[model samples]
Target: MTKEEAKKKWDLTRKMLEITDDEYNGVTQEDANLRFVKMKLQIAVYYMQLLDEHDSEYQVPWNKEQFKWALRKPVGDKKKQQAKEWCHQCRLMRDKTCTNWNYEEVKTA
Candidate 1:
């Protein structure tokens, strides 16, 4: 998902699930399976946000295997470069470094 889409997603998830950034920080590591499941749902929502924003036809597979595949896919060369620039700009606003280093921005949506 693009950065703006990602931000829009977390805004919704954070509100719906009462999830703060602090909570997300612990989810992926503290309790591996359940948190990962939660993350998958959040990520599905994130990608949906992307689809809405970009008018992309990409479809997300909701099964466990799909989540694994999504997690494995690379950001690609050009998008990776752009994402890094965006990430750096985002990092400047937060005191703590991102745990999800590849796709994080400050919770400022």
Candidate 2:
């Protein structure tokens, strides 16, 4: 099955099983299988949030530059250059050292 199909199946199972964050937190480290399942589900949830087609709320954790970098097509030299620039700008923004990182202006520049 495709990853998306598997994720949908897991989500349905989670809903049917009524798995809650509280339950995951209460589980001890000794229960490795439970912990692993919880971890994997949480990651899958985040991945879905990131890949969601409409109204993605997952962009909050990422800056504009990082989000743009993720959205950039991974093809051709032009896109590759834009991706590299976005990555550099994101790092600079995170470091609080970039004084001239205007999104619209930089995109045209």
Candidate 3:
């Protein structure tokens, strides 16, 4: 089945299972499997959020110079290393010096 169809099926199955103490006693194997899938999905979503937050922390402002640098073809290893260092420095400076980094500007740009 397609991803959307599987998602809809999972949602429907989860909704059908009532969350109550009494329902725990007679849990069928199918119910257990569905619960396991639901738990895995929850964990996967949590990890994805964590990864997104981690990536955002490393985000640097993209000005004209940076944009131009990014568009350059056949960048040398030295240039790539320099760029990585510059990005790292930017993140450090942002954390230490800039107490209020303009997130709205970053988001808009």
Candidate 4:
């Protein structure tokens, strides 16, 4: 897929998942817990795209850092809670970006 197609797919996935700005920002920035979720989501998207390709042995474009993140799943209640929060934040961010990429509009008062 082209770059625009991939971006559109990412945006559409975020919207369909109802991701909010807080969640998106959490992973995009310095939130370690949420970053895991972001990586997982991106990884999943990559795999999905791979499945759609006719070449089954095609190599995915993910780097080392992404694989490292995707390899570690959240364990225990506390970590799970953090992961849940991250999912929520990500969903919110996705939703916000689906429309306009406005910072102020995404901020909740």
Report the lDDT tens digits of candidate 2 across residue range 1-109.
3445545644753453344576556555434344444344344343443233222222223354643443333324443444345444434333342233356533332
Residue range 1-109, candidate 4, lDDT tens digits: 5445555655754443343477556653344544545555554554443333212223334454643443354423454454454445444445443354245533421
Instruction: Give the higher-lDDT candidate: 3 or 4.
Output: 4
Candidate 3 local lDDT, 29-98, one digit each (tens)? 5444433433433433332233233333333334447534532443444445544454455545445533
Query: lDDT winner among the candidates?
Result: 4
* Reference-based lDDT, residue 90, model 2: 37
Better of 3 and 4 by TM-score: 4
Each prediction's TM-score versus the true structure: 0.30, 0.25, 0.29, 0.30
Alpha-carbon lDDT of model 2: 0.40
Regions of candidate 1 where Cα sits further than 4 Å from its true position: 1-10, 17-30, 56-109
Better of 1 and 4 by lDDT: 4
